[model samples]
Target: MLLNNLNNDQGFRNFYMNKRGPIINHLCFDDDVILFSSGNRKSLKRIMRTLKTYEDVSGQLVNKHKSSVILHDKACARRIDRAKRITTMKQECFPINYLGCPLYLGRKRISTFSVTVQKILNKIRGWFFKFLSVGGKSVLIKHVLQAMPSHLLAVMQPPKTVFEIIENAFNRFLWSGSDGNKKLHWSSWDNLSYPINDGGANFRKLADISKAFTTKHWWKLRTKRYLWSLFLNTKYCSRIHPVTNKWRNGQSHNWKAMCSIKVLVENNLGWIIEKGEVAFWYDNWTDLGPLYKFLDPDSKPSKLRITDAYQNGHWNWPACGYVVSDFIKAHIERMQVVLSDKPDLPIWKITSSGKFNIESAWNFLRNSRHESNIVNALCHKAVPFKMSFMAWRVFHRKIPSNDIIISWFKLLASPNCTCCRVSQPENIDHIFFQSYVASSA
Candidate 1:
């Protein structure tokens, strides 16, 4: 309300967002506020007056010590000193930590996101990973370590180096159970991160997890009704809807992260047609996707609503501008459009309820990557996981057996059955069957 009055008074002007982009005056979340404005003495003094008025009315004082002024490097000396005197706050640099996440301009550096990697390590501090069994360690990594980067990854596209450093920590903890000690990782992460059915250890990769969830943020832009979403739509996605938006230069990193999985979002999205509120030409209301694709470049209908052709529980065939082929008719016939007072909703086709979920997104992204019936056989519920863990290793030939070691290290000594001291290739078959101890048993 105060901002509305200020705009009306014409006392302050917001900073330009991008090249011909929306003017974002401020972004407020919880108790924190991020104000954006053109650097000028008049606007700076106006902001100070507004803050003073807010403190007077609300009885909540603004902390000058906690706040700092930041200006563009090109901001003139007079404007900087005037801004400092008016705002009564010291000037700070880029990459200020606010609300526990770093906010900065331009490209991210190693030190920029290094704080996130340290946060993951902090979660595992004081733990004796060396003593934990394989099963116990797996549980901790999945539940604790893996969850550490989720919030940051959701907010921004994380650096590939950040993912690598964190994954290396997971590998170090899983194999040696200690950061200092060296141990052989019998299987590569690609093999180990696959589901149990695929003969893997069922560890999820952080990169895949991040990619699957990038679409979730885009899903919220259209589906969620919130103040931030309103501003986001006004500021960034006004001219183009998120699903169909092609890339453009000078876009924000947050928007770039959401666009990373544009294909997945477009393909998996389904529309719940109610009152024909969805766009007929652009929305994916049919299995063949948007109806616009079927028409010629010059002939596609403009401003045509689905309700224009829908009547009396059937499609009015002549209402369409283009020829409706038998193939197109078949797809349209299968669509169930319900007329109700409820507003139209976009559905995430990956889930049954038409709602987006992280687990379902992950499952959809990771689906068919691995399929093995051995999941039921190798992992048992009632027994100790130590035994199950060993059985899992043995089944995948991941144990440090002489045969496996010989393949990896190529020891100078010829392979022998270490258990029976037999002069033969120390292979899984010979050690388990042909040895005297196994033959007599």
Candidate 2:
């Protein structure tokens, strides 16, 4: 019926889409209907008349007062007043929240979402994290504090200042002594963001969290076929299909963030070579990295799919224009290939489950580099969270011994081991091994 009206009514002008023919200027999801028309009195009246006619026939009333007009560009006051008179609706204010997204024209500022910042601070101020054990604090930080700003992060990436404020609150809560006194920081923020077994407390990093959410959006764009994706396809990616086209800068902040994360996803994603969607030379199909990297830098590149390197469902090494190394040959031999009618698919290599998730993304970011094998030894089923945290402190040599405390605050003139009444400084090695009490115990 909407399409019929667009075809028949001369007053109705379809929205001009760049990639395709004009489309109907309306969006209806469930019970909500948002109608779009040109910024003119005639078009507004036509839409109002159409809505009234539909309502009269369907036994429903048009709520004119509840409706609003939101203009992105600056318009003359008289023009806006005329639009208001035509539609009998008020103009919405800028920076209004629509469907949980802040809509405004111009560069994003931290103060654009001041309400979110206050909420985080209020939640932190109410908590008494000092009374809790290290493990307890860890659990609360993961389950409560980290999860607090999740809705905001999903739609809009918060500024660095916002992230820092939240992280500072977490840091103060993590290291508060009795009666709200400050305690010495045992480890750096970067080390604490690692997994528990990696000699630091496992805390959520906002930067990584932001990247993960944006990456999930990219995953949805690739896997889900919907009206929104179709609109994106028509507007930004009409010339080339997403699989083959390089990412471009997006006009919107959300799209730009997704493009940045898409680069990160490219490195961790592997192809499940079915029907040769996987590029032979560029994609990570074989156990080895992209085959193009092995070729001489002077060699010209070509668009080669994985199927090109197969003949009669067997390996065809000569198809590649490079001299195949023995190592590459062995790696190819181990890769099982079964050609079928299915198209190729992508798998997240960081996860054993072959799916994209927040946990897998966090683990990838946390342990991808500088991983310590001591994680295996430090993490045991029998150890409690507090004990494990203490052991981690010991491993990092971060215990607040007398010598370190004195140096950190200049509390004492001497660096003597108080427990043993010795003149030597009290360090990790001395407190744990050299002291008379420690040796006796």
Candidate 3:
């Protein structure tokens, strides 16, 4: 029975014992054993008797070590010892030179391990050169050859630095873009135009070459070559603008426009104009209050001041209030006709009513009647309550009426109602209800 199947049988040992015969020499279940002798019937009977006697006295079978075998031979043992000695000798003589150093391999007589190491180093060097392309291949090749050892001639050799490898690779192809013998034409004023015997011919030659290389014609011819080299070598060259002292191909139109405005103001009006005025004048010619102030403040009948509010906040403009007042007054006076006509327009329909002043009209439209009442009635409401009220009072210049306040609250309480939707949203409410009607009507 298979070892795994033995678990099902209760008397597996007894079953095996029943099957024992003359041909069977031994039986073992783990460490326990039974031995049989089958040389002759007489010897077998003697062995069986000894086994039975042993079972009765000690309850164990005969040990094979203590039992004698009739056919023990010396020749088989001698042959096995000789075969083991031969195998050991062959193992000792196995070739180790076949697996050389891994650093240098494939090109010369370096070890395999040395060849592999060299290959790895080459890869690293190549990556470095890919970023820093500066020199020629010959320079790198010379340095590498000098560094390489003399002994590694068969297995492999180290490659030159990445720079050299790339140079050599491109050198193999004849690039049409590369200049062969086309000499740059030197002008008569160039130093190189005269012979070296002349006093400044050498200096002239240097200057001429520099100018030729920098000139439009020569540059056009070499542009492709120079760009190609730059791409392959991963090197970049840059030029700077003379006037701006910045690296750029073209001037900023914004700066140019500003300069032009400054020049025009200085030449025509004898004034120093601000950048804002320049921009404003450029956008709309009639909107020239600031420009007029900059040009001839004395000539203008109205007092005018120009203030930068943000700059004043930072203490950048000291007389900001005066400037702002003057600038605003001047701006209004300049557009006096337009301002006077504004009231006649539909936009000032509320002002045309003559009941409420401009400030009152602004206040009435600024806050929803409901929101204002909610804040006034409930002191427990958030701080935004007092803040909103204060802002309206300070900016709009009037307290809201109770009717307007109650209507605002009703609108807020309504659900999905048109009056609520139109009036409840505060900014939209202020715009359509107040500002838009006043400005457009």
The most accurate candidate by lDDT is 1
- lDDT by residue (tens digit), candidate 2, 334-355: 7778877898877888888888
Worst 10 residues of 2 by lDDT: 241-250
Where does candidate 2 clash, by residue pair?
A: none
Residue 434, model 2: lDDT of 86
Each prediction's Cα lDDT score? 0.74, 0.72, 0.30
Better of 1 and 3 by TM-score: 1
Question: lDDT tens digits, residues 219-337, model 3?
Answer: 12112245323332221122211111222334332222223223222221211223222122111222342333443343322221222322322322333322334664456345422
* Predicted candidate 1 versus true structure: per-residue lDDT over 280-324, tens digit per residue: 676787867877777886663654568888888898878877777
Task: Report the error of model 3 at residue 308, Å.
Answer: 99
Question: For model 1, where is the 10-residue window of minimal lDDT?
Answer: 367-376
lDDT of 1: 0.74
Model 2, C-alpha of 111: deviation from truth (Å): 1.8
Number of clashes found in candidate 1: 0
Off by over 4 Å in 3: 1-130, 134-138, 154-441
Give each prediction's root-mean-square deviation over alpha carbons.
Answer: 3.5, 5.6, 46.0
What TM-score would you give candidate 2 relative to the actual structure?
Answer: 0.73
- The backbone clash count of each candidate, in order, is 0, 0, 39
